[model samples]
Target: MDHLTFKLGRPVTRTTSQFIVYPAESPDAVRHAVRLGLASPEIADGLLSPGRIRLSLTATLVAQAAPGRPQVVALELPRPGVGLDLRQGSAAPAHVLSRFFGPPPWTERYRQAWAEIANLLRAGDVTDTSVVVLTAGEPDRAAAVAEGLILGSYAFDRYLGYRRKPSTERCVRLAGSVEAGEMRQLARRAITVAESVNFARDLVNTPAKDLGPQELEDAAAELARDLGLKCRSMTPAQLRKRGLEGIAAVGQGSPRSPRLIVLEYAPARPRYRIALVGKGVTFDSGGLSLKDGKGMEVMKKDMAGAAACLGALRAAAMMELPVQLTVFIPAAENMPDGTAQRPGDIIRCGSKTIEVTNTDAEGRLILADALVLAQEQGHDAIVDVATLTGEAGRTFGNVLSPVLGNDWTWVERLLSAGLTAHERFWPLPLLAEYREPMLGEIADLKNASQMGGYTAGSILAGAFLAEFSPKTPWVHLDIANTSWSAADLGYLRKGATGVGVRVLVQLLRDLAAESVGSEARRRPRPRAATHA
Candidate 1:
């Protein structure tokens, strides 16, 4: 893990650096550029009007070698991407930022962009402690730019033999009266979140041999203990006694049997209580319905949902959000052996019998039992996150996560939280029309659609889990596409994305706020003096 540090210092007029970054707010307003002594007004204007500056209708970034500033190189700062419209007309702040910020408003996008900038500066022989991130406009937004750099430069290379020492120690100086304390706190929280996200990615990146069901349980228990939260894991005997047959069926193929991990965050009189269930298939080989060698290569990440839920739990514990959270992870490995579950096998999940039509559709089976357990435990809402379907990826690409649920309000709340956290989501229907396709001839339901697995797979998976949810509001997040990056996307590198940590953290915070506001409204206010 590459740990990042930040320092806050007063702004200065004339600073010397091998590289200087300038935000191009307006081409006509060259006062700041003139003040920085980059060039004379006429010269700067002439140099900036070239094809590089005027090529794009969207904001532009122009970097050039400064003529008289010795070794100094200047880069023009602009919004991240070109012509992105996330607001299909919604006036949400996150959407507004997404539309205008050039970058897709995802923190990782900003992080990735800034990381690249730092690499460029380092590659250009600017091996100093810090780079000057000078910006235009309100100047306060410089903190955001600073955060991007801090988070984007993160890397996980412990398993690799080589380590590259990074230059640029701390001071991310910008021209503003930004509160040093607030800036530090921002960086600190960003570091915490970044570390947690990276931790999740690490778990996902680890091979199944090292991170099996038992190993993942141990990791979760360690995180819980360190975070000062309560942790407990149900052994195979316990799961079997409680009739968690779906879980048993999935893990029986492996010598390392299934375990149900439960972690609790109970603050002093928590304002709200919520349940979270994450799918944890440590290594999925699709059981008897085996996948090809290429398909099974990345199966270690089938547990990303579980990793994300654990990461979110860690964040909530650190932030001490005024909410009680119960996290349930159904950990298992789907392997092919004599003991492995086969297609058409009947497995009992809670009170319902599920006919395993396709052993590949095993995630929802374990999730069903966990969700039922969450409901029995009592909570205001229940949410399950999973990398459950490839069809979802084919539909939305890797840009947006898909959400399906029974409650409109909870679904909408999750979507809103996603936008606010910059982990955007889109809603999919759990339509009654498709619910019928999940029925099994011999059992209460089928693990998969008998017709085929391709059509509306994600939503059908949600429908299957819905059978086990409590009367409380429940939401299902399908992050199949958003769980990994093929290449570096700003803040995120080419590995596990740790996609759900921030979104769930934000959701808990919102629930805490709602709880506080509701309490305040109920409190007795002073009866106005109505003396006639």
Candidate 2:
């Protein structure tokens, strides 16, 4: 697939093929467009009628421009009816505009506006044209235009015969404070992240029969080796030797066995060490507690968490971020067989024993050993990602995953990083109140919190993993819903969403940047992406 490239250049006047992207965030923004020559003052006045405004994306304004005049492609804000409350140009009108256009969370509507811009370009099949993005002041908001374009350009039709690559590789020229070189750099970064996301997407979309623990480990090893990161993998016996019984237990049913794969990128004298553990259930059949056929169909994507970690580590290494990182993937295919773990079976996970009450909840079991291993390594902080529960999906849907942890500050920072990266999360309270249901009568903990009335299955899963590392500044990301989608949404294909990779990569970048800032720093230079 041909990747879209954005080139930054000094702004200039143009005609014919030229397209203008104007943000109609507020009435004042519309007027500002006039002041910037993006629109006529009369056009700004016309916006007051509401009828003149296009409610979604850049729509062509015919007879709106004279011969030789640049085409005005106005981007309409989502939910256009509510934003124009006469208080638009008040003292602190930015508060109104921001509130209206930039909701505190995922301003997905705003992104949709941007996505629609791509939709316009793609629809027209306009190729090799320069798109001049117009905005007044707000450079951050301006940058989001580039973000949405790249996002909207994402496609994963490689398996299909008639698959066509995203059309129109336009030159994206930003008419703002962001330098062309900077915009080029941001595009490169976004592309690298997107490519990794697509990499995870490919991994999760592959059939589990062809992508067992060994294949998953081989992929990680190849990525680590090519990216200059250290790679190591443990066989089922090695896992048993290391006392990772919980990970080994669920895989006993499958002939493929399990693997404990570790990839490390240790830069010299790195300021902080970050450890990430991902649940890599290549395919899940729910073991002895088999899931119904409907529930088992999409089990191949269960390894999305592991794919995400691999993608994040590869991106960080590819970007040469100055942070030491370690990623653990407890990979296996959970199936029901004669030797499969039973409902009442017990397995040793790190220092504690967990009773398997529901084999369908096998994600947490593998993650248990991986989390303990990460915490034991003395990393500065640890975070685990898993598609561990259906309740999480039921509660949050495919929008924001649930984040829980003991360290509120770290959770807040990670979630904020997710927000900034456009991979949002909603914080679920990790109250002590949630832990009561996790206790196991026969063992230290139970893999399944099937106790009646405890409908917070996602939270209880987090609570169960919490038993591994009690005091580490750890964060838990339950990506049960966000990992895959039945319908495509901006940059996300219908299958694996490559959910956590961007957020985790963003977190590492932010940490690396934060460290550099504290020491009289400079933004790390971008490097060429590593090839297979």
Candidate 3:
């Protein structure tokens, strides 16, 4: 795939093969066109009218210029309808253009808008674009544009016979007055973060045949070596010797052995130490309790949480964040065979024993040992993400993942980070009563709760893992729904949304800021952002 190269400066006038992009709402777009001698102000204004161009999420007004004039492209915003409401009896008059539409969160809207701009360019078969971002004087908004463009352009067509070739060397030139140095820095940061997200997407989109436990460990080790970080992997024999029977049993049926992949970034004199645990069920066939035919098709995506941690670790290393971080992935494949684990099987997961009430509920069993390993190292906090339940998907429905944790502070921090990254999460209560359903008759707990009959299944899975890290501040993100999209929406591609990676990167950046008492630490983050 070709990555985007960003440049800042005004381009010299050219008649042929020249296109300029502008925000429709910005009067400056028309003024700039007039200044560039592409069109008269009145002509440019007419080009942007609703009747002149069709607009859904976005619209483009393509103008054929005179021999020496450059072609003009205006990016139209959605008219007031559906999501946009007109507030009645407000101080601002309805006729006021800016106030005509109700206030959606401007920051996120800018991000989504720019992502649409990217889609518009792609539709036009334009790989290189000259864009004028109307940030309304906020320079930080420019970074959002860079982020949206990179994310919206992601595609996973590696397995296809004839795939659309991704742009190999695209360029986006920003023509603006923002300080050149600052623009470059912001753009670089956004590029690093978005590219990390795409890396995770690639991992999740890969077929299970090629990305089993050992391959996943190899990917982590390669990342660690490239970034100059520490990497270690534990084989099935080692895992069993170290008292991680849950991980060992889940993969015993498969030809491939399970692996515990550990990656670490330890900065000297670090202010905080954090552990991230991810459930890496490379292929979840539901074990002895096999899934239906249709359900099994997307089982390759079951390891999205592990891909997320790997992506975040890559970003932290590239960005050189100050906090010390460790990532743990308990990689396995849950396939049914003669040697597969069965219902009523009891497995020792570190300090606790779990009854395998349902072999399909295997993600939490592996994560249970990982959480124990995280706490064993005595990190400040632990966050584990997994595609652990169908209930979470049915509840959230690809909108936001559900998060349940032992500590409210850690939960709120994740929520705040999600808002900034635009990869959202919703908090679910970890009720004291939620723990009762997992209490096992023969073991310490049941891997799947039968008493509740699938009621609160997502929280029950979280409660099962929470038993291992009883003392550490822990947050569990159930990302089954958000990890892979059923259809393309906004910046997310059709598959492997790479949900938690951005949230983790943003969280680490926030923690790094708070570590040294930077000015960003004083700025309050919204508990959540309004999702479209």
Candidate 4:
């Protein structure tokens, strides 16, 4: 399974059974190899020729129609020796290779394709041979391959004991030559991000019976302690004193109390102060409004945004980004009980009051308190992540996250980061006209909209968040859609996709770099100001 790269003229040796991709489809070479019994021209023709062929698992010996050999081998374009064709490189070619090698048990060809691509990325090159290396054999070439395989193999099968073992395949490996240092760094970063995402996924996947608001607070505190960051948790009384009525009201009905947990990481020479607020509704029973049986099934994932924020913080701290970061998580559960906040209840937030038209619209209420606290800390910019609206899912589906921000520059930068990370987000308008729906007669605003159903729920939520920070640069991420996927694709596994963690980390890194550059520009000239 060792991967080696050489130019065409170099001496070629194959000690063990190996697969090679030739550049040309010359009949002469095929005939010669067939005569020497070195390869099977028919098998080679089947693979090298255009069009897809799905060989049965029972089929043996892809190289020859001979008995007791490897099952069907798939081959496609650019032949072997012809240079890399970026246009022709695809999962189809890789699948052919997977069929040839026949991966180990419980592994899928798609996962192998991902591993192959990751290997090529680590090698820092892309060409015709790169595709072959990705598909032809076991991924033993680069350390980065190990990293990607470990990452793509994650599964949340903890609750599936009674169900039959899923036939779904997982696991991938890559083979290619790569620079050791760069490969190691890539592997390390991939592991760091994957582990963080897995952490978030685990938290989201946990049953509500075990991970209540208090438990979530403890988990955050533990993460802070482990990362050597400052952590603080506010009790119900403290929340009431701070006028965090939104969070308090939501949690009053549950046996588990509400908490406002803050984690801070201050660099020595901070360039910019960034605040992240997350809505951590551990479980959403929809309070007095009450969700039906169907709506309640996935209520465990309501805290997905909070989990992502926490995961991003962990990654940032681990990477030691040179920015002052403050993470605020308002952890609570919206449950139905005699003491629960009713639909008609009016709660006073930090700077304004909000009337609750629907108890299910509780995420915004908790975020209201958290955002106020973030602004009070005097952050230069703020980003809040929430599983706040189903309208977001209906609008953007599961692939794209909807982002609303006041600052165009920040929003653009975030979108760039999302693209680089392969996560998707679309910026939505925050028009002044949308503000009217949230206005309340008695209170400053209402959590539920008076009109405009799913058409603009994401934008409306963002408009509500804008009320707390009138002047501060802010971005609201409504990740209701991208947080989880029922099906697998690319490197993403099903359930708790941990979609925003990488994008957030990348954004923070970019922000830190910009802050450093700004600081350099703002440095005081010697004696110039005093003379002036």
Best model per TM-score: 3
lDDT of each: 0.66, 0.67, 0.71, 0.65
Please write out the lDDT profile of model 3 over residues 1-532, one tens digit for every residue. 1123532111101111222334433344444421211111223323344444222211111121111212223222333421212223212111111111124445566666666655655444443433333323346655776777767766565565655543343444343334545655776787678778888888899999999998999889888998999999888788778788988888887989988899999987666788999889999999999999999999999999999999999988899988899999999999999999999999898877888989999998889888888989988788898999999888988788999887777788899999988778998876667778888888999988744455778877877787888777788999998898889888887888888988999999889878455553342321221110
Better of 2 and 4 by TM-score: 2
**lDDT for predicted candidate 1 compared with the true structure:** 0.66
After superposition, candidate 2 runs with Cα above 4 Å error: 1-110, 119-124, 129-137, 141-143, 162-177, 431-433, 515-532
Give me candidate 3's TM-score against the actual structure: 0.81
Best by lDDT: 3
TM-score of candidate 4 against the unseen true structure? 0.73
Question: RMSD to the native, candidate 1?
Answer: 10.7
Clashing pairs in 3: 2-168
* Candidate 2 clash figure, as a count: 0
> What TM-scores do the predictions have?
0.78, 0.77, 0.81, 0.73
Q: How many residue pairs clash in each candidate?
A: 10, 0, 1, 11
- Ranking of candidates on TM-score, top first: 3, 1, 2, 4
TM-score of 2: 0.77
